[model samples]
Target: MEELLQQLAGKLGIATRFSDGGLVRKDYEVDDAVVRYIAERLGYKAGNRGEVEKSLADFEKRRWQQTLENIYVVEQGKLQFDAVVPAEQAQSFFALQIENKDTGIRSEVAFEVHPTDETYTIGKTIYVKLLVAITNELPVGYYNLTFTVADKTYKSTLAVAPCRCYENPALADGKIWGYALQLYSLRSERNWGVGDFTDLGNFIRMCARCGADIIGLNPLNVLVHSFPENASPYSSISRLFLNPIYIDVEAVPEFKPEDLSEIADKIAELRQSELIDYAEVYPLKISVLEKLYGRFMADRGSDRRNEFRAFVEAQGDDLHKLALFQTLYDIKSTYIWGGWTAWEDEFQNPNSPAVRKFAEEYADRIRFFKYLQFEADRQFKQASAVVAECGLKVGLYRDLAVGVGKDSAELWSDNDLFIRDVGAGAPPDAFFPAGQKWCLGAFNPYVLKERCYEPFIKILRANMNAAGALRIDHVMGLMRLYIIPDNGDAGTYVMYNFKDMLNIVAIESCRNKCQIVGESIGNVPEGFLETLAEKNIYALSVLWAERKDAGWGDFNAPGEYPEKAFMSVGTHDMAPLRMWWFGYDIELMHSLGLMDEAAKNDTYHKREIDRWKLLSALDANGCWPEDNLRKDNYIYGQGYPEGIEEAVHRFAAKTASKVFLAQLEDILHVEKMQNLPGTDKEHPNWRRKLPVTLEKLEGDIAYIRNIQAIRRER
Candidate 1:
């Protein structure tokens, strides 16, 4: 039974044992309950020994019967693959036709198969291996391959990809410096309340004028529109679309703020609030969006109307799914049903007749949602244009979140693409001792292969659109995910086809002309970083995580950093330099009840040591002020050190990395973290607004001097 369980789990991509985040290999004992649940999910028999054995035999038979996989990823110059065929057809000629999906060009080649000794038998029929080589050279792109062997037709997707992801030619000239910040955190006097695409454009103009090459942004993926307070960009409703809330309502054609003047006082109050009230902001923006949408529908000009139509047509089914999902959520909100999972079975199924009727009834309302996306896309393109206009090498480096929310529109649209019951998260690590259950869904590896990775390809294309670069959050997910089943206590690992996924990423990167950055921060598997570097996918190196011990200890000096990396002072999850140097994060965690008295005491002690070590490292790198090593500064830990923030920025800028990004919060010495990983509502995670407005930030003497110092250091 144990052996059978192992075989079944292996076939299902479930790791029998895995290396944890701590770099310790732990054997996962086969749990009967876990195995049973997984088997049932994968449509395998786990009732008894006899049934399990039979299921295994059937799976093996099916595997051997298939002549070709659903897809194959090959290098641009290597188009050779192995195929299985009936023994009698081994010596027959095979006709292969490859059609480029983009160009609609087809190439034909006839090749005689070279049979190998490897053979498999099912009943009376025998299958033999054939080495099929194509002489026709194909460029880097996706192609539809049709193979005919003795009148038998076999179809598969052939992805010819570059050996490595796209690397910006500017990098070869010299390393570049940039700023990373959450777009929503921007405080702009002109914005309605929350930061919008217009704010992004203003920021680009400011940073580009400062000689910046890139601007890193938090994920702009769409979230729950009605329940906007669930505002973790990392846990979005759909990665395929942009957040409409970030749309500049005033920028929308035909918008008239005076027409809605009654809410002027409310908008003023929201704009002045320190933390964003997404609940208030979402409704306000939606109200204005609805008005603009209505006006456009009533009196849009031919050119503009045709543009919207073209966008809708270009977006096609994905746009339809997103709009339909939003429309259904709007209607379901009347009853306040728990989620799509709790909806009536008829409504839950996207293709059900009942859903079709609901969609037809709310077709106009659905169009309203599509209009929002269109405006958001248009504004994003406008903002991205500023990168070139300002002479920035890489403008608007967008982020792609690791996974979608559990009950998101993405899950509602396609059930087979994801494993609904199991949740994706991280294993226990130094950052979070209890581990984390992200409450996010994991994609089914089997389903991805079956679909020729169409879902993944679409997601990359969507996020890569209108961007100079894309950062893949928790990029280890391309190799494996920590999947915790609903019925299991501790989750296990599920491996993916890493090479194939990387190849596809490379192909998309070249196609979009966008560089790739992989955030492989925690619990990364062995050789993962090296593989990413080899593929030219820049590694994300957080200053806090670059210590010699990989913990709170001595830091790796500036010159020791990787050349092919995007280094930063810290990430959104970590405290800014000011907060870290003062042990404010520990105090905040304790105050929020995330840490006990004992843990807080220990953490504070460690933080003091970390601070001292950080100063020492900076001093050694010649980035720290001469007075920072004074006895008074180290002994009292009183009155925030003035030059430390600049010193930290200097330290990061001097790293060997090809790209260095200073967090806006760190540069401005903001004490609050953009996100506190463990807490949700308990802490103001993603709601904190920047202290200064865009106009003030650009003109502030201190900010300008800091940028100048960084420029000189780099």
Candidate 2:
């Protein structure tokens, strides 16, 4: 079993990799069931010893010829492969499909490989090198490489990227101050049940005045509109587009505030809510937006219409496909349905005649969908401009989710680029013992290259536009992803060409003049940080995770944090700073039944010790918040400690890290966390609203003090 497993692992490149931290190999279950699962995932199976031997033999015969990922440098290219056929029959002609992404000039450049008179033996394959010079200029973007040899076409991809990321001007000092927030959770006097770009604009202006360089946000990508209850910012419906729910209806050009006398009633009703009622907000906003779209269209003046036209044209087939998908989806499902999968077969294919007929018949409806995106873009761009005018450096920090839901516009539009049968997930990291299935179908590396990463580039450009910095959630996904088969309980790791991916990220970052920050946490692969550093991307540093000793791990010195990191006290998935300080997370987890009896007790014991170390660090900086109780008094049995919130703020602020980001929850000391991972309906995920209104937040004394503390640390 061991010998067979090793043989399979070597052939499939499915060996164990990465850790929850910088060290420790990730745990993988390789039982008979798991072995079979891996075999099935890799397109092989062994029923008995005799069959296993035959399968092993077959795998060895074709292992070299099967190219999972074909990688090459920009312009200068190399093609290496193992061929089972006669070397003389390998007459290779490389056809490079280059798209000048910036200018939109696409042309095919073909050339022959050098020294084609090469035959291959059974044991070894031949290598071919090519200087792929183009007659036309090509942008630093992904391209398609097609190689034809012996009457067969070998499909591959060409990824073009610069050496490093954008030269960040904000790196003058080692420290920067920022505030992290979930945009939808924000409450404002003007918002309609949820925070809009208008609220974000105001927040940006206020944060700038309070000496903040950036304002981090949850993923602003589009979530399920028809299925509002499935509102998770991290698990989005589409990562390529902005959410229309966040659009400020009042900001539209056709919006007539005076004429909205009747609609004003619903707006006020939504604003009065504590938790975001997505159901109410969806209908109310969509109805209003449809009215706005009608009004805007009635005025046949093509100036705004021309802008919309340019946007559609610039967006290419994607915008049209998304608009059509939404139109078709609305026609099929409504109110509570989760996805667009149940639609007609003709509608399923974006290019089908049924789709064309539906699109033309419901042209106005489709335009309304396009108009919604346009308004979102306009308001978001305006808010970003406000960030700059208000003098914030990395003004509106954006988040890019790791992947999208299986039934998403992204997958629907670009079905060829993803592995549809399986979902992407993480192996058992230190946190999730059973591992985590994100329920997202990520891009297939081979197909991603085959398609020249067209969908990927669009997703990146859309996110980078109108933002100062982009935070790539689960950035480790670029290096490798655990792909779970539909038939398997255990998943196998599939490596990505991160060298090319990083290069592409660098190119996009530089093009947008935005800094790239990667959210890499829990069982990181060895040298992943170095890869990010090579691309000049920043890392995420959570206060609770950073420890002193490698043994049990205590808090380390603030000055010892990563030079290029966004230092923060808490993450959305974890307990807030106040909860950590009081050891309430343990109690909360206990109540939630997240841990076993032994695990719970052990966690509580370790947290108590870590709490003391945290307090001592706060005391050393003279930032301890207790009115009378100090660290010494607490360690030596004080009566009680209070006001530790202020101490926690200052603790993160004093870090010599590149950035100190204080979440609005921690700044205002909101007791409840934004999310609790591994639990869905048990907790109110992505629906919590801010305790204070945006208007009140600007003038809040405590909030002001917290921001000032962070700035002082910077």
Candidate lDDT values, in order: 0.85, 0.73
Backbone atom clashes (below 3 Å) for every candidate = 0, 6
Worst 10 residues of 2 by lDDT: 75-84
TM-score of each: 0.97, 0.85
What 10-residue stretch in candidate 1 is worst by lDDT? 23-32
Candidate 2, superposed: residue stretches over 4 Å from native: 1-71, 74-160, 172-174, 334-338, 344-346, 596-602, 625-627, 631-643
Top-lDDT structure, candidate number: 1
Best of the candidates, TM-score: 1
